[model samples]
Target chain A: MAETSRDAKRARTAQLILEAAREEFATRGFDGATIRGIAAAAAVDPSLVIQHYGSKAALFAVAVQLPSNNADVAADHLLEVLAVRLGELPPETRALVRSMLTVPEAEASMRQFLDERVENLAGSFDGDDAKLQALLAVSGILGLTITQHFLKLRAFDDVSSESLLEAAGGWLAPAKGDT
Target chain B: MAETSRDAKRARTAQLILEAAREEFATRGFDGATIRGIAAAAAVDPSLVIQHYGSKAALFAVAVQLPSNNADVAADHLLEVLAVRLGELPPETRALVRSMLTVPEAEASMRQFLDERVENLAGSFDGDDAKLQALLAVSGILGLTITQHFLKLRAFDDVSSESLLEAAGGWLAPAKGDT
Candidate 1:
């Protein structure tokens, strides 16, 4: 009984610490935030934070949503997956965008992350303008992201899932004769 | 010489007032900004602003770019025409988006403007989801608007106009069989 209770307590403490880390990093940014501040904010001993997460950098890595390894999926497939996931759009879409606009590091990191993924999407096409085509598709994807999640526009949010996917299909696919 | 110099001075002053109006609206928003304040910032008499542009609302109408009667354009043709206009994207894209984000009136006005246009696009389709589909097409068009002009990301800006038009083709057309 004692061992189970201790495990539960440890899990709760870890989660509380993660929430604090996210708040600190989001508010103060990477260079501006501190480990002790996060620990104090979490109301946990500083040593426990380090013992559980290793370091501030590691904690940030765990707390923030980085581009998934799944980003390697081709552009068409990615759009299909995203359209299907519309009803279950990731919660991080809004937070990441809000933070990216507000924080320099987050903006830089997001730019870098998108650059890599878009390049992968472009690589699939055959023309000299493949990257440009991929970029146009990405623009549509971002529009959906911002409206459905960030702007929360009523026109976008109230869309049925099937209609949303249909709408995405017309604008996000590329054609060989598109040039 | 005096008359010619006076004409040049008048033109320059008008230009300066417009620039100031742009800056003020961009920074402070519609409700939060004032013409007297704009004239002061422009280093011109308040009367000159009124003399040149008539009223604060008139100045806003002149200084900001609203969609032309061209906004009466139907969606598919509008997208094609806009895609062709890529190299000469209107300066108002960034300024309007900035102001829209900052001002409630601007946002509301833009929403109303888009709703009417989306409805026109929806009227062309025969499904119960026509409005929703039109809204999605609007998303793609807006995405292109933001990326190609407003955000000015390197990935988007580097594309040649020919490539951009081609890229815009796949996703913007009204079709039921996108797959």
Candidate 2:
């Protein structure tokens, strides 16, 4: 089929709205953000946002997806990624995590997302407690994320990612039984 | 020197207001809660709340203190305490954590609180990196707390605290040289 300029224009507008929604949600949080606010940021009509995404919750869902296979990264690879993850989180993920606790809808989405990650990680291990072990691993990562991204703890500023990885290796290794 | 009827009534009213404040903050978060609402919940006039607690921030500070020397419970004993910590968080602590990220004042209070804990925990360790190690250890504990307390991940419900304490022991042991 031939490419249509109209379809391309629609895709561009959707992308613009998504980026705007990410910033609005991240700065103001879920309850604080609104359809009109997101639309204003995107320079689009509020109706256009509704036409494209349907509702505020629906737009948020699309805005905050984790990269595919985020959980599949082997345990050792986590340290390398942790170095990057320790830095600023993407606006979308930040929006989701920031709002997850206070907002019921955000909490539901985050829970489902975390459960899927745990299930995937568990598939690589053997034992009845595999899921539990995986859950703990995920929890550790979540803790670090919250501390660095949300809490902005100063203690972390004094240490290098390599040092952190070394310190964390002691326990993280036992959880996986591998490098 | 004798206790007066006037003093007793004042203490009781203060306690009642504190309890209501805890519940209001926990359910509505820092930004969502209001002095009027807290007073209504406590069955008191708003003036009394202000008279006792100068500001909302001041009220929150007293309400959400972690137990004295919470971090002083040596690494090995953490498991025993972990059993208790894993249960539902107190409404006061929950209220603080619920608001920590989005609320600037809450985040500052939480950061200072965590730094003191890391410093206290580091006092027991050796080496220049002791503080960093303590920070990671605390991060792990914070992760577990957030997962169990706020996220309410179902995986935790399936596993007994005994089992969790055991599984976590593998990594936690290495974080601290002792059991």
Tens digit per residue, CA lDDT, model 1, A1-179: 99999999999999999888777765454545688998999999999999999987677666666655464465555564334445554433333443443334445555655565567767766666678767766777766765564445666655676667654554344654321
Q: Which ranges of candidate 2 are over 4 A from the true structure?
A: A1-3, A67-86, A127-129, A166-179, B1-4, B54-58, B67-86, B127-129, B167-179
User: Ten-residue segment with the worst summed lDDT in candidate 2 chain B?
Assistant: B77-86
Estimate candidate 1's alpha-carbon lDDT, on a 0 to 1 scale.
0.63
lDDT of 1 by residue, B114-171 (tens): 6665667777776676767667666666667655654456786567766566545433
Task: Report model 2's TM-score to 2 decimal places.
Answer: 0.82
Stretch of 10 with least lDDT, candidate 1 chain A = A89-98
Instruction: Tell me the tens digit of each residue's lDDT in model 2 across A53-169.
Output: 999989988877655456455655544333333466678778888888787777777777666666666676677777777777767777777777778788887888776665555
Alpha-carbon DockQ of candidate 2? 0.57
TM-score of every model versus the real structure = 0.59, 0.82
The DockQ scores of all candidates, in the order shown, are 0.24, 0.57
